[model samples]
Target: MSQIPLEHILLLSAVLFCLGLLAVITKRHAVVVLMGVELIFNAANLNLVAFSRYDPSLLQGQLFSLFVIVVAAAEAAVALAIVLRVYQHFKTANLNEIATIDK
Candidate 1:
């Protein structure tokens, strides 16, 4: 069976991670930041699965990826709940605007 090169997968993962980092660093919206966090999680998952495919002796990588996915889902739910509350209370979802402690 044909297989993808490890380098290609790693490169894609790196690009995804960089884009996610950029979004997390530059975006001011809470939702966008959450999405960026999800992207990073996905990139890590991709790497884990790719490595697992290369070495079939153990399925630890795939299992860990599954765990990460589960955690990411739970995180999304809680994070969205918090974001919604912040928006309702502050009248805006902008992280920069809501970051003020004096309000």
Candidate 2:
């Protein structure tokens, strides 16, 4: 079986990153923003794995990707906890309203 080209993988990663960024910027819900951040992390992971395929010996890219995954998981847990607390305090998950309340 022929391997997929790196360029195609990178292109897909770029698309994922852009879509994630758009969601993070345009969506109002805290959960949606978290999902967007996940998408961005996934895009980076994809790129890392794709590049790792080229030099199988070192495995640096794959290792780094694993580290990133771990960090992302921790980040998600902490962020969700913060969001939950914010929701409890504010009674709403809309980021705009949250920001307004801060002032």
Candidate 3:
């Protein structure tokens, strides 16, 4: 099987990472930011899997990525729960509004 160049995979991952960072930075909605965080996690997973393809001996990279996926799932669950509670309390999911409410 012809494999894609590592550089290409890395570049794709970098682009995804950057886009996620931008969303996290520019978005005010809690849910949107959470989605951005997911994107970043996915980018990391992509890198891990890509590297593991090259080194198939132990598949440690794939194993690590699996752990990361589990952690990300847990984080997303907790974060959405918090967002739900915050929306109930503040009537808005905007981070700026939530911050102002705490003061």
TM-scores of the candidates are 0.95, 0.95, 0.96
State the lDDT of candidate 3 residue by residue for 1-103, as single tens digits.
8889999999999999999999999999998999999999999999999999898897899999999999999999999999999889899999998888878
Predicted structure 3: clash tally: 0
- Tens digits of per-residue lDDT, candidate 2, 1-103, equal 9999999999999999999999999999999999999999999999999999998898999999999999999999999999999999999999999999979
- Judge candidate 2 at residue 86 and give its lDDT: 96
Instruction: Report the C-alpha displacement of residue 79, candidate 3, in angstroms.
Output: 0.5
| Residue-wise C-alpha lDDT for candidate 1, range 18-42, written one tens digit per residue | 9999999999999999999999999
lDDT of each: 0.95, 0.96, 0.95
TM-score of 3: 0.96
Candidate with the greatest lDDT versus the true structure: 2
RMSD of every prediction: 1.1, 0.9, 0.9
lDDT of 1: 0.95
Question: Number of clashes in model 1?
Answer: 0
Q: How many backbone clashes does candidate 2 have?
A: 0
The C-alpha local distance difference test score for the whole of candidate 2 amounts to: 0.96
